[model samples]
Target: MQESHSNESQIQIRLVTKQSEYAVPDIPLSVPANIETAGLNELLNHLLKENKPDFLKQKQFDFLASGELVRVSLIEHLQERSVSVETTVEVEYIQVTPAPQPEDSILHEDWVAAIETANRWMLIGCYDHSVSIRTPHGKPVTSSKEHKNIVKDVAWVDQQQPSKGLVSVSHDLTGILWAWEEGTDKIEPRVKLRGHERGIDTVAVSPNSNRLATGGWDTNLKIWSASLDGDDNGEPASKKKKGPSDISTRTPIHTLNGHKECISSINWTNNHVLYSASMDHTIKFWDAELCGIKNEIVDQKAFLSSSWSALSNTLLASSADRHIRLYDPRSTEGSVCKVMFTSHTLWVSSVAWSKYSEHLFLSGSYDSTVKMWDTRSPKAPLYNLQGHEGQVLVVDWSNSKYLVSGGTDNYIHIFKNKQIFK
Candidate 1:
């Protein structure tokens, strides 16, 4: 033990480990206030050698203070946590667990274009012109009938009914609504929506479940009523009673025409705010309440997919240039990307933020891999998940525990990490 000077402050540190037999001293150790974490780690390794010489060489350890990993220098961390020399800090030594591998793979018949999770069900839209709903355990629940062309995207309606509803858009130039019947594998087509002049690329259901938005190759974003009782203007049909006849006849309430190229993706952050990405190399933020574009972000590279962070004002867009750009809509700079993550060797086709983590996100690319990124470290992905044999088109973080990726190889890969859940 080093002697402390009169001017040097002292802090008591207690080492806690997972092993029951690896007993640390009952009393805390007095250490200099300005000691760095690396110095502390070195001291701990030396102390461990007396009782367990091989432990230090066989396993790696992570230091945690108050449940947060101690990544910064000790002095910096102390200042950030307001830890004075008079306070005793509890430092925990935890073994660094390896990332979990893919637990299972579900094979598909065609390329998966979109994926969404709700409750216990996982929905997938495939190039086979159909949408499938399955269990996270890879059990197929039901699938929709094939459309005229490949299915582009799928959205689940936030309905109160146990038999939830879903809407899907397709290259068939139409959107179809399906209703799942309880206790059965049957998914019945409730409505067929048609208005776009070309294939519809993506569809999103508003948070309130009252409105639906669809973007199409015709460079138009259209808003429609989620209910089957209304007309183009959202007024009830002239007939006294509504039936299946009124479903397919409904039109869009608004058609937002601004993009010079095909719309690739659509995301509804809230009931009133919608974000649309286009091949025109731009992203437009639309105010659904005012029926107008509130903001626009122009980029040199075309955007293939976009997703809003559920935990922050941040937005992520996967570009045709094979990069994922993070944007802060609240920034004064118009659409200036805050961070660029560029490990993907091919076009990034999809990006999804973890619903449970504010800064963690997942991206899939045409390079046939899914990369997990933490905004705190943008230079490299936290994990590069490689299993897909073809272009990975879509990825989803399911319940913050399972990571699912779908690709042109007609396979759905699921990954799990115990550390991620912690």
Candidate 2:
């Protein structure tokens, strides 16, 4: 009876893969039902040993059974899901992305609240009331100390131009535009924007580089001309009293109002379309031409940050609920919330989509960690980045070669992607 039971414990599994390079023969192999993911990977690699490159021998794989990752023993997963083991199990395999390597850790004087990378430059905003520009390798170039309060956000205006532009928002309720040509000694302030009744939390440059938008704690979104060629709106900024600085002070051309609470984040998708997330538990889509809300996705938790992917036409947003959500605004049949990635233990403070891969993104959380994710594998993140000692405030994957993140720990951590994912 014991010999008969032992023989019955064995199951047949047929391995398959969508990756052409890793494809194996579709023959079923009998193995112990107690085998786990690592065991299966070893077995699959053995099958691909013949006629394969040396590098392929070192690669790892992930297995999926019935559309779910096989994280436990084969028999355990099948029994938990009430799957029948009498028949052959068909498992799909995918190449596992190696963990990103730590590249550099840049120290900051205060909490690193915001970060952006593009055009071979890295821009970081700090609670020390400064915005600093640095090389991709963490060499400081120039910085600006014109903001009176903590710098909450920063953005690159035009990466295609010879000279780059910058916009920084602060708790002082103002946004400053600056000019910095490569190798310049200073980040010269060009214009000072004042209109938000409360501290500005987020800023986004338009796709065309002709306009910019800002959202603040006053529950308002404002748009302004990004042109630095114009003279001061009124009198010379240097001659003004109790307002304006050496640079001009300009008011927003349009004020968008709909959120019932603070506007936490804003992103511009095109010249005429934009989106804003609010503490009111909603993400609103607006038509910039009409200056009104066109559609919205209501959630139970307050949104902390947002990112729009031009490649996928999808919206990614983090919330106080500690989950990162992927939404498809084009879906009119059901809920806009498509996938909810629930791994972070605390509030998800920021999210960024990979510019090179439509299916890849990153999320930083108050739990003091950053996670790399692929939209195709929604069940789990590809990697969990651990470096920050405090809440991670922002993450940037704008650069194809680098993944950058900043946190309340007063440090900017950079990682190099092994695969560029292009």
Candidate with top lDDT is: 2
TM-score list, all predictions: 0.77, 0.86
Cα displacement (angstroms), candidate 2, residue 211, comes to 2.2
Q: What tens-digit string does per-residue lDDT give for candidate 2 at 196-219?
A: 999999999889988889998999
lDDT string, candidate 1, 18-83, tens digits: 655555564588776667657777777767776675565744555666555566655556666666
Which clashing pairs does model 1 show? none
lDDT of each: 0.79, 0.85
Candidate 2's C-alpha runs over 4 A off are 1-18, 25-34, 51-56, 65-68, 74-90, 160-162, 231-246, 376-380
lDDT of 2: 0.85
